[model samples]
Target: MSAYIAQACTIVHKLIDAGHHISDDDLLLAITAGLPHFYDPFLVSIDTLSDSEYTLELIIP
Candidate 1:
């Protein structure tokens, strides 16, 4: 698996082990939502991408 996928899986596993009943969609959503702050480096490093990437904004506050 790609490093990003592996990292995401690890995060999901940890959350599940901690008793957070998050779905795969939810997990991806959370990551995508947080990516602006959390994955800024990765995003910036990839020059071919545009700002149109998916944003995670549906997360419950």
Candidate 2:
């Protein structure tokens, strides 16, 4: 795996081990914390959307 993917997985695993339920908000906070400052505006845009809207925008298949 790439370094970024490995690091992200490690973070999620640590969170899981902490016994807290992992929600979308927790994942988002983790991502925003790791990304560069240039991504802040994009992250803020995501924060403004409803959960359904955010999922739809992701276009997951």
Candidate 3:
């Protein structure tokens, strides 16, 4: 998950350098938004969670 986030940050940084605008919130959303409906329950679970309850290990492990 660290790797995924790192790669996303890398891409986002490039996008910013290229003059496209993206925010941390946007990147966070993009990460989960790319998941298919197969993960709907998991996504919904996270949606209802406090920020501290959400962890990358739950998603990637």
Clashing pairs in 3: none
Where model 3 places Cα greater than 4 Å from the true spot, the runs are 35-42, 49-61
Report residue 42 deviation for candidate 3 (angstroms): 4.9
- Tens digit per residue, CA lDDT, model 1, 1-61: 2465568778888989999897755765555555656666754554344434332332211
Better of 1 and 3 by lDDT: 3
Cα lDDT of candidate 1 equals 0.58
TM-score of each: 0.45, 0.52, 0.57
Give model 1's TM-score versus the native structure.
Answer: 0.45
lDDT of 3: 0.75
User: Of 1 and 2, which scores higher on lDDT?
Assistant: 2
Model 3 error, position 52 (Å): 13
Tens digits of per-residue lDDT for model 2 on 1-61?
2475458757878888998677655655565577788867977877887777765226211
Best by lDDT: 3
Residue 28 shift from truth in candidate 3, angstroms: 0.9
